[model samples]
Target: MKKQTINQKIEIHASAEKVWQVMWNNDSYKKWAAAFMPGSHYVGDLKPGGRIQFLDPSNNGMESDVESVTKNQEVTFRHLFELEAGNAGKTLGDMREKFELVEKDDVTTLFVSSDMPEEYFEEMNTATTSALQIIKEMSEQ
Candidate 1:
């Protein structure tokens, strides 16, 4: 069966740059990403093609490859695998996620899309939406 893309979006009353910062900046990332996994943070720069280790407070989570990045516009990442007690496990399937930001007249529409296996579609869709909502609240502050 062909996998479907899970898309989520939110409009924030802030500049695209501000929205981008809230989405990527470490501290802010942890705050907004709490919806996905509480106390989540990453260990790596978000540059294109870089490897980022996404971790919870106990250092258990997954890692992803930064596929592409466009300042204040878009960013893409591909899931690699899960880590437990510092050990890497099987991959999280073939999944890719993208975050796009479009600004018009002062409101920025942030769109997040992810392509993953069908079984995980609904849960991740809900999590992504919650994350975006938190990001919107943070950026509008």
Candidate 2:
């Protein structure tokens, strides 16, 4: 399947740390990620080389490796394969997701870039946009 990169960004009236927390913290993550899939969540570490699974309620999702992480500044995940019933399935076509946060005067600009299958581009784009709005609202609070 063909793949394309989708990028989304939002400015939050909060510090980079606050934005980061809202994006990665388990509780807040579920709220924003619900835009993609209901009961979505991640399991595993966030450091380089750590293995992570982004799963929905049925344990079906993507398995990835943390390519890099820099606390409140940046984080990247390289998707390896699709997870079916909590098991590794087909390869994910070199998909990757990255998040970058830039802060100035306590305001944080959060940028998200992800590689996804062409067929799902439009749907993912809308979901990402809604997810960012959720994150912005949570971070500001």
Candidate 3:
């Protein structure tokens, strides 16, 4: 399946470390991730070569490999397949997601880039915008 990359960004009035914490901290992750799906969360490790599951309340979502991680700077995931009933399903069209943070003068710019099937471009783009807003709010507060 052909995929298109969706890019979204937000500038937060906070340090990169603060933004990173808000984005990855378990509790905060759920709060912002709700933009995509209520009760959305992740399981497993977040280091390079680790496997992580991005799951919804019903145990359905994506299983991805942690492609790279640079504390306070960047993280990337290569989504391998979908999950249904906590089981791996079909391949997800070589989709990948990356988050990069750059700080200047105490403000952080968070950039999110993700690839998905063309059919989902709009939905994912909107979700990502909302999610980034949530992250910015949480980090600033």
TM-score for candidate 3, please give it: 0.98
How many angstroms is residue 27 displaced in model 1 relative to the true structure, after the best TM-score fit? 0.9
lDDT of each: 0.87, 0.94, 0.94
Cα RMSDs, all models: 1.8, 0.8, 0.7
> Which pairs clash in model 3?
none
| lDDT score of residue 107 within candidate 1 | 98
Runs with alpha carbons beyond 4 Å of true place in candidate 3: none
Separate clash counts for every candidate: 0, 0, 0
Q: What tens digits encode model 3's per-residue C-alpha lDDT throughout 27-125?
A: 999999999999999999999999999999999999999999999999999999999989989899678999999999999999999999888899989
lDDT of 1 by residue, 16-108 (tens): 999999988888999988988898889987899899998988889888999999999999999888788557976777778899999999999
> For candidate 2, what is the lDDT?
0.94
Off by over 4 Å in 1: 1-4
TM-scores of the candidates are 0.90, 0.97, 0.98
For model 1 the local lDDT of residue 64 reads 91
